[model samples]
Target: MKPLPSLDVLKTFLVVDQKLNFTRAADTLNVTQGAVSRQIDGLEAHLGYALFARQARGLALTQQGALLVAPLQQAFAQIGEALAKGAAQSGTLRVKCPTCAMRWVLPRVICLQNERPEIVVEVTASVSHGVDFSGEQFDAAIVFGTPSLKGVSTHHLFDEVLTPVCAPELWKARRGKMPTPGDLAGKTLLHPTRDRRDWLRWLNAYGYEGLPSTKAQHFDTLDLAISSAMQGLGVTIGDLSLIEEDLGARRVIAPFSLCVPSGAAYYLVYPERPAPSPALQHFAQWIEGEARHTRTHLAAYTKPIHQPIN
Candidate 1:
């Protein structure tokens, strides 16, 4: 392949194309008119075509030069975009969050965007509960688990408070009576994990043996399982703090009133840099305040005396 002309010569051609006059183009490029002429001459020789025709009145673009103008302009515009995206001041904050936490994280993120219109927040939801910051391009992530991850700063959001929740229609199907631990015997049980670890933990804490394996439905993420339950598919163990809005709206009802605190919790995590980006810092502060508000909301729920489920 023939070597492309240098960026300097290509840029000179664009300036000349826009101004249509060598003197003005030279002035715009902060170069001498003779230098501009040499660049154009060199570019024409490389392409074996004259780009500009010297007219009695200024200059005119040859057919070949006109064709190159649009493509060159587009190429330069794309280069600018790539450079802006590589810089930290692009005004977009990319965040990764577990699918289960979207119920809690999504609304808060919308609120943050509304309050601070200057910053754009982009969220990626995944089934994985943790992130490898070294491999990902996210500015920050909301992680679910114990806050012991090394090389990252963590801000505790809320505990994984477990409780069985079902659609109001499902609960009302059994009449106005609230459900008990024994009521789960015949009802379909939704397991968030394939192994049913969350259900087992909560059941163990309540001193209640779990239901039969044949009556269970499994999902990859708690959010999916909870969504299915809200459709009256079954009763799923929900993290009470994350589902406060649903509980308040009566989309799902926690009839048992027994919230078991699993040892793990959700946290806002980011790499421990010497100086964090302003966008990350701003979001961290906002989310921490929101978390405090969530904790207050969860205070009313009855956390029965039970051993903490680890």
Candidate 2:
């Protein structure tokens, strides 16, 4: 293979070719004249030909250099095209979602990828705290509850409702009798540390003064807590939308007829300034559609066990 000119040399050549003056090219490139001359020298050495004829007034392109100009211009144009394509493929669409919704959102993200394969989606799971969109690398986020940031566009995704869930065997052991909130007094309660307040809010909404506290196991991760609940370690408050697959597969059963509004909903947030990219718009539309489908699916299959608080 033939040796190639370095990008630095090519860039210097292009600038000097355009200006026809070494000083002007050096000024444009923010480099000293010495550096520019060295780059041109290296470029000419590699090609085994003088690119420019030194003149008293300025510099003139040699016959060989004139011949190379058109091809180098085309080469640079092709390089630009490749760079744009790479940016489209690798440009990140950063997103943040609640830990509980990660399971539901990740699977649906596969569908988004099918629709727009060029954009990469980066997801960060958190409990909706300390999200700094301006300081962080995120281009967009899907957060639960209200976004505290001002001057950003926010779209409501869906309301999350909590329901009591346990393994099917646990339900069978109880002889198919659904437990009320009071009935949970004697049973173990698997709790997500982030949603600890949810239990209290739910109990308060039910008009229950105080319920018996059983042996409680706290899990930092929603998936781990859900898995532990599915194994009949204890009953857990679950988002019906997230656990629909486990419910459908009979891995878990709702042993309570009571449910409570979680006082939180999902939101899609982005900067209000710079208009969104085509990729961001496409993803937002797809996610909203999927969320609607999830709601409809939940309504059709899962019975509402809890009434909304007034």
Candidate 3:
């Protein structure tokens, strides 16, 4: 425990590491580029190692700098989440979730807000997969996969099963004969740009390999792809958690008993801190309860029970 660098220096290092451009980091910190440079120099002298390397693109972390990134992120994330608690209504809570959750969770959040107007919660949307909570200023994130990120606490929301979903009219068009996974061969399939692998995985499970991969329509988000499915344009593989409302409303149905796990699951993510912050605790309890309701709906909808039971 020798003389360590201050929080300001560490924060500057993190921003520079995150952006890899001192100028951009300076703009974000509301400081001059020269000040940013000086901070880095002083920090480097304190630690007695070169923290960055000059490259054509920008500053790259040296081995020493690379080692510090995760720990530094954890330290700051804890501080930020703790402070965010005090900053909530007394200090506002900023939450980040991806598109699919945005559609499904917004109403629930509003309900939570209504119940507890005392807490101020702000929710923002992003592509949760591979998103860096460290730089996003998020007190928490509802991400599409398990918690692998360094600085955040992750909770299992639910594991996803990709179910082939299509409009009720499309199923009815088949005229009462139950549709099977093999039936997808003759129909258009919708693909979400981010999780297109689910389509291939499901196709392989059903042995529908001969269909041309490009035959499917692709959309940038899962919400868009499912919307296309609801219009009777085609069938899309849906994570039941995301499409629970549509399934319950009879807007879409899984045509077969077959459901394939996407090998990824939804997780509740927030920056790592020693103790639970007030805001984080409030949101976690509320969101986990919402997810439990969703899990039950997800389980019920993946079956073709909407069709006449045999």
lDDT of each: 0.82, 0.73, 0.76
List TM-score per model, in order: 0.69, 0.63, 0.71
In model 3, how large is the Cα lDDT of residue 182? 54
TM-score of 1: 0.69
- Candidate 3, residue 233: Cα displacement in angstroms equals 2.2
Residue by residue across 1-310, what tens digits does model 1's lDDT show?
Answer: 8899987788889889878999998775667999999999999999999998999999999988899999887776556445434645777888899889998899989988898988789999987777655335677899988756566898988888888899988875357775567777777999999999888887777677766445888998899999999999999998898899998999998887677887788999986753467877888998999999989987878556355765
Considering only N, C-alpha and C atoms within 3 Å, which residue pairs clash in candidate 3? 87-91, 87-92, 88-91, 88-92
**Against the true structure, whose lDDT is highest?**
1
Per-residue lDDT of model 3, residues 103-190, tens digit only? 7778888998899887777888865453454445667778886566775677888877777899988864467676655566567888
lDDT of 2 by residue, 1-310 (tens): 7767676688789779988999988876767899999999988888899999999999999999999888877776556445434434567677777677788888778767777778678788865433444334466777776567665788777777777788887654456564567667767888876556656656776667554465788887667778899888988778777887788888998765556766677778876545566787777888888878778877744455455554
Q: Which stretches of candidate 3 lie over 4 Å from their true place?
A: 1-86, 130-133, 173-176, 212-214, 302-310
Candidates 1 and 3 compared by lDDT, better number: 1
| Models sorted by TM-score, best on top | 3, 1, 2
